[model samples]
Target: MKNTKTPDLPLSIRAIIVAFRVFFHLGWTKISKKLGTDPTTVQKFFQCMQRLANGSEDFWYLLSHIEPSGCHHPAPLIAPGSEESLEVRKAVLKHKTWMRNNAVNYERSKANLPPLKCTTVQNICLDFKHAAANPKYPKRIKRKRQPCKTALDEEDRSNWLQYTQDLEEAEAESDILTNELANKLKDQIQKLKDTVSQQQKNAESPGTLEWELLQQKNMEICAYNDAHFTPA
Candidate 1:
């Protein structure tokens, strides 16, 4: 964590707690108004504090850096010297343990409860924060988020995979056909080019007018013989 100099009093702790609130999506304006300070000043302090937390430490401690670690529902407020509080504390810890490992909605659903509002959770966090500042406050803990299960089932994934494979196979077949067509056309073009070249060479040969006419007739007869013997 970066070396940060918070005020050497409860105001500094208040500021740190406010920064934590800000990390939980609370606006700086609301916190500042409640604390009777300039909104921007509170925001500046929070940003500085976040920068100082170098992010290579405890998960809850890392919340000082504003890194997303899921919704941290504040630790339950435990009053001092209460005998009946033991069971309440156990229940609270059990619920908090779920919140720490899973998303709010997921945990709520697992407990067969309706989804809780984020604002409600934030208010609870503030209450806990106040309780934490108490002389006999116990553990300071919060919720952590877990990755949600994918919506697509096995059938959908398999269908998508097959669809992708089919497209690849079609593309590969098209490429092969395209190459074959190009090669076939290239051979035909080369044959036509050779025929043209032979005609050009024949044109330059010396001969009498009558002999040249007879030569042309003979060449035409040979061409006809060759073409007539070829397959349809």
Candidate 2:
């Protein structure tokens, strides 16, 4: 069964939220004010996200369905692996601006320094979710089963004979006393089974004391496992 626990939003989305979560960690009405987008757009973003969480979406497919204007972009038109994602580029640009203002200023701003930006890692959690749901990827190949041997090896056959002989001896030794006890247990068990079946037929609910006693008898039968008739 699939786990139903709600997972945390990805770090990229969490970072985006952090940018706008100040003051009250408020509703989209307030957060959208920080995001410079309308509250309705925020509502739709989460609506789509809830659908995605419920295993109802693919990666880019889910994003494509979102209100594109909310992110200032339409469906993905950028070539995969050819151009940086718009979100990553924005984060990188923000980092470079921060570095130029804070870090570089400690020396001399723009002192012939190379262009700076944070190296944004490609986020693949959505792809993982989509593949886990729809499974477009290949699974591991299974090995073919080998044919069974026609006959046991000599040592194995000899061991098997000894084991069987010992088992027979054990059974013979136990049988005499076990037979009489077994017959008594068998009648007692049959009575229990019939009574239990009748109790189940009579019960209004399954959890009454009579039902529990019936279940206990079934458990006892399983534990006892009669000789020959119901092999242990």
Candidate 3:
């Protein structure tokens, strides 16, 4: 008989390996486009892949057995502290309260109750002070005001006004140049039109051979139009 048993791998390591293979095959661009994730995340996936490849078999075995069904529910809140740290303290207090209440109920059923010594009231002021002293917290931003302007500043204002006036004069000069060119072009066009009209009149003069030829061409065009464009 041939030995054909496959070695067992951890679910977590196997998941990471699978994830790496999928990411590697997809590449950065395709992964980013398809998943709407950054390339850095894709790069991190490759790093994870490398670690799995070099790591121990136990890691792979542990990963393969892992399942989402074992997830724990979050504890309920019971602490009554400041609004910011209320949730954290509440969770701790709720756990304490649950234990104490359960113990008292159990003892009452047995006709032997134990006095509770647990206290949930915490001094969160010290925690707040420590947090405030931490450098990670953002400092209050201060707004700076603009310095007051004096009478001597009027000279600077006048200089800016003069600069704007010079800019406007330059723009006006450009507009005048454009208008002059347009007028010149219009005059030239009109002159050309007049010259063409004079030439047409000269060609159409009575007794000219060109005039007779034009009449013959017109007659041919009329005949062609009559033949091709007749009413149905």
RMSD of 1: 18.4
Estimate candidate 3's alpha-carbon lDDT, on a 0 to 1 scale: 0.50
TM-score of 1: 0.27
lDDT of 2 by residue, 1-232 (tens): 5332213334454335434433245687876555555666555566555464464434444444343233323333323233223332333234443432233233323444332222212222123332233233312212232444578899999999999999999999799769989999999999999997877775545788776877788878877776436744
List, residue by residue over 151-225, the lDDT tens digit for candidate 3: 648888899899999999999999999999999999999999998787688677977766787888999999999
Pairs that clash in candidate 1: 1-54, 2-52, 72-143, 100-144
* Off by more than 4 A, model 2: 1-147, 179-232
| All candidates: TM-score | 0.27, 0.18, 0.27
Q: Looking at candidate 3, what is the lDDT of residue 23?
A: 43
- Runs off by more than 4 Å, candidate 1: 1-151, 206-232
Cα displacement (Å) at residue 177, model 3? 1.1
Q: What TM-score, to 2 decimals, does candidate 3 have?
A: 0.27
